[model samples]
Target chain A: MFPTPIQKRPVAAQALYQGLLPIALIMWLLPLIAVALFSIRPFSDFGAGNYWGWPSSFEMFHNYGQVFFNSDMPRYLWNSVLITVPTVVGAVALSCMTGFALGIYRFRGNLLIFFMFIAGNFVPFQILMVPVRDFTVSAGLYDTKLGLVLFHIAFQTGFCTLFMRNFIRALPYELIEAARVEGVSEWRIFWYVVLPLMRPATAALSVLIFTFIWNDYFWALVLTQGPNAQPVTAGITSFNSQFVAQYHLMSAGSIVAAIPPVAMFFLMQRHFIAGLTLGAVK
Target chain B: MSVTAPAVPHAPSERGWFQRNRMTLTPLLFLLPGVLFFAVYVVIPIFQSFQISLYEWDGLGEATYIGLGNYQELMTDRAFEVSIWNNVKWLVLYLLAIPAGLFIALFLNQTVVGIRLYKSLFFFPFVLSQVVVGLVFSWFYLPREGILNGVLAFFGLEPVNVLGDPTLATYGIIAAGLWPQTAYCMILYLTGLNAVDPEQIEAGRLDGAKGIRMLWYVVLPQLKPATFIAFVVTIIGALRSFDLISIMTNGGPFGSTRVLSFYMFEKALSEYGFRMGYGAAIAVVLFLIMLIFIGYFLWQMWQDEKEARR
Candidate 1:
């Protein structure tokens, strides 16, 4: 209702606004548009420098097939899945506890611990780079999906805890007090009372964590170097090196790597937005 | 899951530690797994990096201690200085997202048909990974054949080799980074706009305030939470910039696009003989810079907590 609506604006302004909207969007998405177009173009057409022109043929299926068959795309995808799934479960489960503790209870070192988690979450992963890698190697977990999973679980716990705590803190205290007065055990209160009320928060956190782990490039690169344990993000990098100017195949591979997160985002659109904008609007 | 003792209320002081702090202790049990992982993975490693900075080792060999030598090397390393300076530029230029986001939020805060689709399409770039974004931008910035170059040729200008040109390459990568970053900022601002009180806008309009003046004097003040969050995330994103730079340039054209994160990766890994110590030093410096801002944010949160308690 605000901004007087486009219909209520001057006719000239409305016309100008409509015209500019598409132009602005096109300009903004120019790069993505180019690559998406290129992905369907035949290699011959691409090699012939007909990038901006209409594609000579639709080779998207062929290009994508080649990425799947020739490269370690499946293995990489499996590795990503192996790492991300456990990380989501570990991070969410861990944060449920941490968030509950920090949110519901008052104790010594409460603020100190909360601040530490927050501060730790914001630090660059590079600081943890050497030590984490060494620890991974020493545990003989290097070049294994389990290695990446362990590190991710640990790292994500920081952000998850912060988010979870804020969410749990915002929950009404009266419900908790009422449960306590009824002689319901603390664990039962959490499981039956608080847990059900936390559905939205849980959904939001799950979607966000899923995307975060799926798209993680830094740790994937740091922890694993080969396709044996490499994730899609790092796999895309290696594929980039091998393909070298094979734009169609690279584009196809890029699209493949991007699909899971994009799908997750679309599927959980509400929760994704809710999670992302948690503190923003409030 | 234990039976409760019959209600026999006693003096609060006489309660055992377990009873006295039962609520807090119970939660800590839940916190143990998370706190332990956080400490091992995030907290301790930071100090570990600082310690690693003092040693010289190719991860496989014994680490030889060389106190402050890496810092000395960093002092004279032109590549280090240039990368650090580029990071400064990235931090500053990347901040344009905040205002740009607000502008877009205002533009889209209308009850128009197909506007929801428009917003989603605007948000498309953010849902994809940075690797995809990098590849897309690489194609766009390619000489002669790239869409950007095609547009340039239409205007009678020769093709510019953006990625190949050392001077322009960093800017090219930064631009790519900005695409998603700006979308993220816009989403934040949109949420902020949604929460803006209608009555306040009505009051402002009745007072004859309009356009930029209305925004600056009224709307923005109400959008403080969104702005604060946007600022925090954007600054952190800028500092932790690695993916786009790695994919697009690989610190290329003589490492012109090297930010600290990528540079640290190159130093510790890649074909650079794994100077983990030196890499850790670079990381430590970046962490120290981030720590300053993190400290300020925590202080503000603490103040808010104090006020809430009162």
Candidate 2:
């Protein structure tokens, strides 16, 4: 309502506002749009230096098929799935119990533990790079999907705990107090009472973590090596290196690597924003 | 699982010490798994990394403790100097995203038809990984075949190589980084706009305050939380700028674009040979730079916690 709505302005100004919306969007998304257009073009388009011109032929199916069938792209995509899903489940599940304890109970050292998670969540990833890699290597989990999954679960728990704790803290304390007075065991209280009410935070954190771990390149590069364990972000880079000058194919692979997170964003836009803007509006 | 209706002190005399101290023990039980993992993977490693910084070792060998040796070398290292300069540039320029995002959010904060779709389309860049953003931008800046050069050529000017220019490469990578970062800031601002108090705005309007003056005096204070969060994330993003540099320039054109994060990776992991201790030293420097912000954030959270307790 700030600055007044365009509808409240003159009719010509309203018309102008609507007309400029798409233009601004197109200009903002110019690079992504260009690649999206290139993804459907044939190899001849780039080889001939016909970069911005209309493609000589549409090769959408051919390019995407080449990415899917003629490469380790499928394997890398599978690796991404293997790494991300378990991290989401592990991080979310771990954070729930952690959040419940930190949020519901007032005990000695509670704030210290909660602050530890909050602080760890924001430190530079580089600080963890060498040690985490060494730790993973020593544990014999190096170059494996499980290595990446375990490291991600541990790293992501920091942020997830902060989110889940804040969410659980905001719930009415009376419900928890009433349940506690009935002498329900602590685990039963968490399982039946707190866990049921935590579904929204869980969904929000799950989608956010899925996108984050799916799109992760630093850890995928640091903790795992080769197509054996690398996620699509790193894999697609290697794929590009192999098929150099195949910008069309590269664009297609980029789109392929990007699809899952993009789809998740569209499908879960509200919850994703809720998770991201956890501290913004408040 | 039945709720205990008859509360006769739960027959406390019959319980063992474990059951008697359940209130104190239960929270720790719930916290054990998460705490163990966090302490092992996150907490312990921070100390380990700090310890490793004092020694000299290849990743696979015995560490020789030469206190302050690597830090002494860093005093005159030209690459370290450039990386630090570039980091400063990144930190300063990335702040542009906050103002730019606020501008865009104000532009799109309207009730036009199909506005939601427009907003999503604008936000689409943030969903893609920085690797993809880097690739798209590298191609976007290509001298002959890129859209940027194509546009210059269309204007009857010679094409300039952006990524290949030593002087411009750092700014070039920073621009690519700002693309997605701006989108992220815009989303935060949009959410902030939703929560701005309308009554204060009306009060300002009644007092003859309008537009920029009104925003400065009235609306800006309300957006403080959003601004604070946006600044924190932007600072962290600036310091953690590695993926795009890795994908786009690889610290190329004579290493003009190397930030601290990339330089640390190069020292620790790349084909440059794993000087693990030296890399740890660099990581330690980065960690110290980050500690300033981390300290501020923790202090703020502590104050908030105190307020909540009160």
Candidate 3:
């Protein structure tokens, strides 16, 4: 609206704008495009000094197979899914309840508690890192998917609760008041009346939590040590070390490590954008 | 009209003490699991780290209580100074995202064909993992054959070893970081620009305001919320910048690029004797630095909430 719409713009300016868009897009995505290109490039091409040239032969299929079959990539991916899925479900479900409580209740310390969750959400992870690792070890949950999942669920609850409470608070209170006046049980009122109405918030939160837990690198490093429990994010780091100068293989693994979250984003782009742009709009 | 319908009959027991008090208890019941987990994993650790900082341990055997020794050492440890300074540099450089994003937003705000696709394409960097960003940029900055060097060579200049030079390593990583952050800021500004008051723009135009004058006098003021969020997130991202530093240099070129987060990790986790206590002390310092921004942000949010309530 600010710049005149292209259809209404002068012809020369319009053509120039149209021409630059794709070029700009390519430059913007140059790194990812390079990675994709490098992943298919044969190892021979590297020593041959053909880094950016056309690939001598396409090894894309071989690279994918070797990454998935030979390396611990599949196992790492399973670890990611194992950690992320439960964190998403558990965090979202917990936040829904906690959000309802905080939003609807007229209790003392309500704002204080809400602000604590918000503040805790912003606290540096390093403060929690050492003691958390020690606690995980003592609990004998070290290097286990369960440990990562529990910690993620806890940490994510802070942000998810804040989002959910604000969302639920924005809903009409009359619905709950009507149910209460009819002597409906509080639990029933929440489940039968409120939850069904919270579908959009749930969807937004699920996609969000899924991506955050999946891409989490620091916690994965802290809790999991080996392929037995390491998620793809941390595994990629170790993989980089092993595949030093093996850019093709490393790039392929990076692609694999990125797929789940990328897939989630594309699949739920609307909700994902909605979740991220929450505070931006208002 | 729909409210005139007959009310559903209620069982007398529904008004009993249990039913009447259920509202008060149900919320607490709902809150328990999340609160318990949050307190155990997040809240308690802050205090635990504070306590751990008072001691000396390698995370095995017994921790020796050594009050202030780690802090004392940090006072003189050159690497600590280097990492802290790099973090400050990061914080300052990262602020470029706001203005960069706004300019890009202005450039791309036109309703051109495929503009939506363009926006998303520009936003792509934010989606990729920092590991991938670091890897790609490492290649991009790789001296002789790197893309940047190749471009420079085309212009008859010698290749610059951006990452190899201790002075430039932090800057190189900061540039990589800016690519994504600028994209994020662009998105926020795009959203803000969408909401800018058109009437105000027309009014300014009638008053002969144009270009930077119009933007500064009229448009930028309306973008306050977007700018605030961009500032806060960029600061947090800059302070937490560990992945890029780790993957790119590993605090290298003579330990010149260690940010606080990566430095703390090196102390705690690596086979570097697992100095958990010293690591905790470093973490506490980083946490306190972050708390400054967090406190200001919380105060701002409180003001916003109060205004909303009013």
Candidate 4:
């Protein structure tokens, strides 16, 4: 609206605007498009120096089949799903209680506790790297999916609490007060009253956290070792090493590693954007 | 007496301590699991890392206490200096994503046909893992097989090896990082723009403000929240720039692309042998730098809380 809508413009200008949209999008996504193009090409195309040319033959099914059946990709994918689902559930459930307490109750140390979560959330992961790893190893949970999941659930709680608390703060307070006056216990107020109203926030946070844990590379690298526990982000590196410069297979493998989160985003775009832009609108 | 006895049983004095103290106890009860987890995994480790930084340890055996030894060594380490300078460069250059995002947001703000689909497509990059983005860009910068070289040949210009050259490698990785970052900022601005006050824009238009002037005076003032968020995320993202660097360059072509985050990983982990103490020291430095921003952000939030309370 600020730019003066194209509908109000001259025919020539409108035509020019429409034509420019596709070009700009193409330029913006060129790198990804290139990878996508590479994914469908046969391995022979790279050897023949047909890098950007039309694929001599399309090997989409064969290349993807090889990635799924021949490699450790499926195991890594399963590992990612295993790690991500529990983290989402744990982080969300924990944050819901924390959010309810901070949003509904007036208590000493509330702001201090909330600020601690925020500051912890912002600290660099490197600061936590050595100590967290040492802690994990000492607890005898090292190099296991459970180790990664527990650490993720704990770390993600900081961000999730920030989000959930803010969201619960914006809810109508009278509903809570009414419940309290009716002799409903505090726990019941949270379960029956506050929890149902937090569905949108829960959905938004869940989608966001799922994508986050799924795409996590740093923790997956530090806490886990081999395909037995590593997520797809780290696994793709080994997948590439196994294939080396077979660009077609490597391209296909990378794309496959990236699909779950992308699909999550598309399916839950509204919630994803809502979660991300929670503080953007004041 | 019997009527008084039934009334007494229903009185506050007869309630259990748990019921009487439920108001205070409920919050503490709900907070227990989250607080415990956060303490173990996040809070306590922070203090532990600080303690570890003072000792010289190989992560496997006994640690020796050498007072500030790692920090003293860091003063003379050339790789550390390069990493610091590159971090400065990253902090400054990564900010370009904000304005670039605003520009793209403005370009796509119109309600053209299929605009929703277009918007989603434009935002697709941000959803991809940085690993994928790094891999995609690395191939895109390949000296021989890269389309960038192909494009240069099409224009009859010489092809340059972007990731292979030390001078250009850092910039190449930053550019890759900016791709997703810009998309993130664009979405934030788009959402902000959706909520802008139309009446004020009309008022500005009536006053003869047009285009850039209109944007500067009218639109941008309304987009402050989005801008602040963009600034926060971009700063944090710049500091946390490990994934792209690790995947794309691995601090290679002469270690030209290492930032503090990546360097810290290399020292403490990797096949470089585990110098846990030294790595913790590097992390401490990075933590101190981040603390400045963290302090400022918390202060702002505190001020906002006060205003809301008022």
Q: Highest lDDT: which candidate?
A: 4
In CAPRI terms, model 4 is classed as high
Q: Residue by residue across A108-165, what tens digits does model 3's lDDT show?
A: 8788878889989998889999889989999999999999999999999999998999
lDDT of each: 0.86, 0.90, 0.87, 0.94
Once fitted onto the true fold, the runs of candidate 1 whose alpha carbons sit more than 4 angstroms away are B1-21
Q: Determine which window of 10 residues in candidate 3 chain B has minimal summed lDDT.
A: B5-14
Stretches of candidate 2 exceeding 4 Å from the true structure:
B1-11, B155-157
> Mind giving the per-residue lDDT tens digits that candidate 1 earns over B1-310?
8987658855576768886667866877877888898888888988889999999988998999999999999999998898899899899999988888877778887766778877877886888878778878888898866899999998998889999999999899888888888888899988888888899999999999988888888888988989988899889999998998888889998989998988999999989768998899899888888888888888877887887777
Candidate 1 overall lDDT versus native: 0.86
- List the DockQ of the predictions in order: 0.77, 0.77, 0.59, 0.83
Q: Report chain A TM-scores, every model.
A: 0.96, 0.98, 0.98, 0.99
User: lDDT tens digits, residues A65-98, model 2?
Assistant: 9999999999999999999999999999999999
Model 4 DockQ reads 0.83
Superposed by TM-score, candidate 1 places the C-alpha of residue B23 at a distance from the truth, in angstroms, of: 2.3
Residue pairs with clashing backbones, model 1: none
Q: Tell me the TM-score of model 3.
A: 0.95
- Residue B214's lDDT within candidate 3 is 85
Off by over 4 Å in 4: B1-11
Those runs of model 3 whose alpha carbons end farther than 4 Å from true positions after fitting are: B1-17
Better of 1 and 4 by TM-score: 4
For model 3, residues B135-238, the per-residue Cα lDDT tens digits are: 88887887754667766777999889999999899999999999989998998898889998899988988998877888898988888888998998899999
